[model samples]
Target: MGHWLDRNIVEPGKLPLLLALAAFVLTFLVTRVITRLIRAGRGPFGNIRPGGLHVHHVVPGIVLMVIGGFGSVAVRGHGPGAVVAAVLFGCGAGLVLDEFALVLHLDDVYWTEQGRKSVEIVVLTAALVGLVLAGFAPFGVNELTPDELQSRSIVVTNTLINFLVALFALAKGKPRIALIGAVVPLVALVGAVRLARPGSPWARRFYRHRPRARRKARVRAYRHDARWAAVRNRLHDLVAGAPDR
Candidate 1:
């Protein structure tokens, strides 16, 4: 059994098929157990809420976890397998930490309306998987070349932008809007990155203009806040003086 576990995991040799199968099965089992605990609703041994499910948060996380777990099964001492293993290990670590946080979040003392929406564990896991897959893809398959790390970087970056959009949408309770925002910004960001590459004509122009816009926005924000502070003070004084009237 000991050798089997290590063979199924920690050593990815002559077992690509087995590793893949185990990765998927293990991922599913782990996720179901975690989800059940999350649903059991409170103590170290309880769920986050009474029979409640964090579907959006938990499902994507489950998918990522499976991908990573199987990847772990195939990780050997070096090369692509090693990289995949490291990524899987990181995912495992994140899942453990997140589960701990979920316990805290479920506690009545720490639970807040905003806290209810935030599942840092799920977000971070998704992000990690995105990064790992991007990095692994460019190096793993024969169809891809080694020099495509830049493409991986772009993939990671775009995944982040999508995550942000999803987070914002979830917070606002507008899943459709969030989906649109997630898709649009990601497409735009990727397009921009591609256009900014060495041979593109817009690359130099985009870089030259991006910073200036940011500076202008920051200056505008400062001025706006200054004026708002003055108005706020006046309103405070008026409210304070109302009793005398």
Candidate 2:
């Protein structure tokens, strides 16, 4: 850990929250700049107003940056590595947002084989995984010491990189790209599971919340089905009563 991530430099508890805020601000600024550049490149003097499609593409990126910024705060306790984690998380968030925005804007031009769909799919998967890890960070590994930085960084970085690579494959029309991209997070998630196992803090929180989540989902499904059942029955009856030649 150098100057940017010195645990000794910042108090453990207060720093994470602050760092999370910083991550958010960083993400916001970076995205705004990127959007501006793209817009400028497409027009003269950048004077032309952006259309709904342009705004649509940028909105998700902005939103994810904001989310990851908060997530950075959550993981601030992980020490120096937290900053690295924050940057990576922010990029992943932005990338995912960019994809969904692009998808909505996709039409004949975007749907074409050479239109970079793979990139969007890869980025979206990475963002989703990053979001998951952001929550898990508090329960995952503690800060990486300077000596351990290289190894741990590799694991985290490779996981993220592989996710992006999978998306690239998807753009090329590869069938298993999404699945492969998903595997990076799955592996890390398993590791997180191991770390949080049984007596660990992460495990305790995860298990405690898991059942509540399931119950809520079940309740929602029951309500939705019950509400729609009568409508479905009416349609069936109407169809059944129709005269046939």
Candidate 3:
């Protein structure tokens, strides 16, 4: 175990990344527990308010992010400083993403249905980071041969193609696939070739005049959502606690 750790993580200079991911996941889980307790009025935890203004945790999160970001830059990814900065930044990210809905809507929607966005974003962020940790490079860079990597034009072209495919997936309202596709080009390709979700930008723009296409898109979207939405919601609720009715 120790050999594998040192060989794969420490020697590769991925210790800080591993630490950061651990810190981020732990902070998010802890924060969710406390918030859930407060919501249920069963804990000492409560909202922070000063001078009649309710203070959100994201404020402190932003401060921590600034400090850690600068600290990481200053340390230049070496020594103990990098580890500390990584942990701090991870903690801050957890807090900020926990309130992502608030930032997105510019309102406190923590317990509302809209707040589910926060959980989704956090999960997506974690998954992407995990993919990185698992050695998936963005834009399929990891797939390049040594000779191909030496060719700047080839690398750029490959990245551009992958990026465009991922963008198409996003336009089709397949954000999860697009995000994963950023790391794995095959995923992006699949999503890009699939039909756009109903009301998605791609559907609205291209399917507008195509009555058959619009109907097909709507039916496909409804079937997809009906098949997976409940499972997704249950997972979200299990992780972040159910939103208020």
Candidate 4:
């Protein structure tokens, strides 16, 4: 285990990334537990208010994130400084994402149905970062051969192709596919060739003139949503506690 860590993570200068991911996930779990307990009125945990102003944890999270970001940039990546910076950044990210709905709506929406977005975003972020730590490079760059890496033209061409495919997937309202495709070109190719969602912009522009295509898209979208909504809700509830009512 130690050999694996040193060889794969620490030696490749990815210790900070692993640390940040661990801290981020842990912080989120801890924060959720406390918040859930507070909501149940079964713990000593309570909201913070100072000078009649409710102080959200996201404030300190932002401060820590800035400090960690700048500190990492300023310090050498050789030693514990990187780890400290990673921890701070992770903690900050956790706190801020815990209330992501608030940031998006510019109001407190925690415990509401809208708050489910926070869990979803956090899960997405964690999964992406975990993929990176597992040796998946962004935009499938890691798939390039050593010789290909030396050819700027080849690199640029590959990147542009992959980006376009991923864009197409996104336009088709396949966000999950697009996200994964950003790391795996094959995923993008598959998504690019698939049908668009019914209400997606792509369907509006291209399928509007084709009733058969529009109907197919709509049916597919409905079936997909019906199949996944319950699972998605349960996952959100498990991660961030179910929405109140």
Q: TM-score of each candidate? A: 0.26, 0.25, 0.98, 0.96
Q: Give the number of colliding residue pairs in candidate 2.
A: 4
Candidate 4 Cα errors over 4 Å, as ranges = none
Greater lDDT among 1 and 2 belongs to 2
Q: Across residues 1-245, which tens digit of lDDT does each residue of candidate 2 receive?
A: 66644544364343544444445445534544554455447533342245733334344555555665665667654757566556555554544443443555554222233324433444344454444434333212233345665686755765565555544434333333345335444443333322222323433454466876545545654675689756754552332221111
Top candidate when judged by lDDT against the true structure: 3
lDDT of each: 0.43, 0.45, 0.93, 0.89
Best by TM-score: 3
Compared with the true structure, the alpha-carbon lDDT of candidate 2 equals 0.45
Write down the lDDT that model 1 would get: 0.43
Tell me the TM-score of model 4.
0.96
